[model samples]
Target: MRSAFLIAPLLMMLSACAGEPTRMGASTKLVEAEEAILMPPPGSFSVAGITQKRFSNGLQQEIFLSTTSAVPGQNVVQMRLYGTRNDLRYRDDHLRFRTVTEAGIDAEMRGTLPGIPMKRSPYLVQNDYGAFGYAFGRPSPTELCMYAWQQLRTPEGEKPPFAGFGAVQIRVRICETGASERKLLAFMYGYSIIGAVDDMRWNPYGPPGPVSDRLGHSGNPIYPPEMTAGAEPDAARPVAVARPARRAVQPVAEPVPTALPGAERVVVPSPVRASSAAQPAANVAPASSAGGTIVPSPACVGANAATAAACP
Candidate 1:
């Protein structure tokens, strides 16, 4: 019993190391734990929008978009945290980086996430804090680990091989501005900590147990921010995507060749295929193929006949 008590203090220190300290600590990550936890927008008063998707593992992922959506792919972010002190480690030993040797560590397709220009991808990560690659820039170390951790865990609540996760937690959040409300933000707030099996960058112990997805099912229904009662496109909102404009295919009318050079100006005939039923006289291009036989597209008919480059 005395030995267990002595070890407990060391473990608590380690757990708190990964915990969201609301104050930054010594880590190479761009955003420190303090910065990540107290970063203003997610504070008590403000609630941002949240978006979630379920993965094949039955884990649900809830994402929060910031007030102003930055151009996608342009902004990169990571959240590194440590879990409860109960896992076992030193009193001040913060959650270490996630090691590939650890269980549940896996790779995935970027999905909607933009491609990291192959020229710019740190193709390999050393742990939750650092990566190896030949890119123009690398994300701050701490974030890399946290990002990896966030990517590993989903909202549907994917369980790792471990029966219970030890200290340290990490996550990734993409910010957006145009959201009508903050359901996404609330989701992230609720996601971190709470006896959850957190991912570690590197694990010293051989094989941790499995994560029980069904453990502590208490995170209840989320209350989104107040938006209009109606006309909000209320069913799983669709994102607005921009489209390119269409270009005109035909050129302006020119003069037709005249037999008597200077005598009279002849108007060129307009291109037209199938004319209206009311105007059956419209010049419809005779059907034919481009290379093999003459075949006409609807576009080759009617007033568009003049530009029928496909006609024989």
Candidate 2:
């Protein structure tokens, strides 16, 4: 009977062990697309999916997938935003992958990210949000990839609102086929943080700084070079003035003399001026030939003659 009881307990223990669920140490939940904090413009990138995870230690992670595919397989463009009440230590240890940490450490030590069996270079990017350091690589002959990470927290000496801790860690991995670096970086520039924790102290972005004194003051009108002077605020864009087309000038043809039938053609040469020391020739008037053609005098052949002057 004792052996039977022991076997029953052993079987019960084995059944319990087999039925126990695996502990993931974290709770994962599917979140709505609208709940995402980092929102890429709908025109350029639409949210295809989103996953939200809450760690036991109070770290929140939200990952967004865009409609554009990063690689040939099922992978898509991914943007991960992590919010922690304290510092980024938790993320570095638990949230980030081992390879990503190694890449980051290599970047810190070597001034560049270590490529995963490929060549990669550091890419610098800045926008209205903040400046970010990224690593760029070409995964294939036609595809390009860029990875960037940024952490936002209150300044070291500055006190956060309500004496509360606030920090945000952002990670982006984007790839495109036959896309330029500028096109890939445009996502970094256009993404906006639309959601935040309800607490006032959980502000990833601090108070707005004061605007420049020169802005919106007298003699500080802001206008582009293409803007016309004295344009009204509600006026339509100025029309471009059309230039007149140039007229091409045509050449005039010289008149040619025609010879009478059965009459020989005569050739004429321009006369050259005689030396002043030579005696002047006697005047000889031009005579009309039998065919009523006026013939030039011999004296006039070698003398300077005006076009309208009578031959002499």
- The lDDT for every candidate, in the order shown, is 0.36, 0.57
- Native-to-model Cα distance after best TM-score fit, residue 191 in candidate 1, in Å: 9.2
Task: Supply the TM-score for candidate 2.
Answer: 0.51
Q: Compared with the true structure, what per-residue lDDT tens digits does model 1 show for residues 125-222?
A: 33332232222211322121112333332222434355323323334434333332233334333433322334563231224458766565665333
Model 1: lDDT equals 0.36
Q: Which structure among the candidates has the greatest lDDT?
A: 2
lDDT tens string, model 2, 1-312? 889988998998888866435456335667787777678755666776776665422445445455354454322333333344433223334444222464664454233223433344445657776666666667567777666666665565665547435566676666667878878777777788766666655655566679989896898777776677687567598999999999999999898977677975453422432222143344432343445444454556565544224342
lDDT of 2 at 306: 43
What number of clashing residue pairs does each candidate have, in the order they appear? 68, 0
- For candidate 2, give the lDDT: 0.57
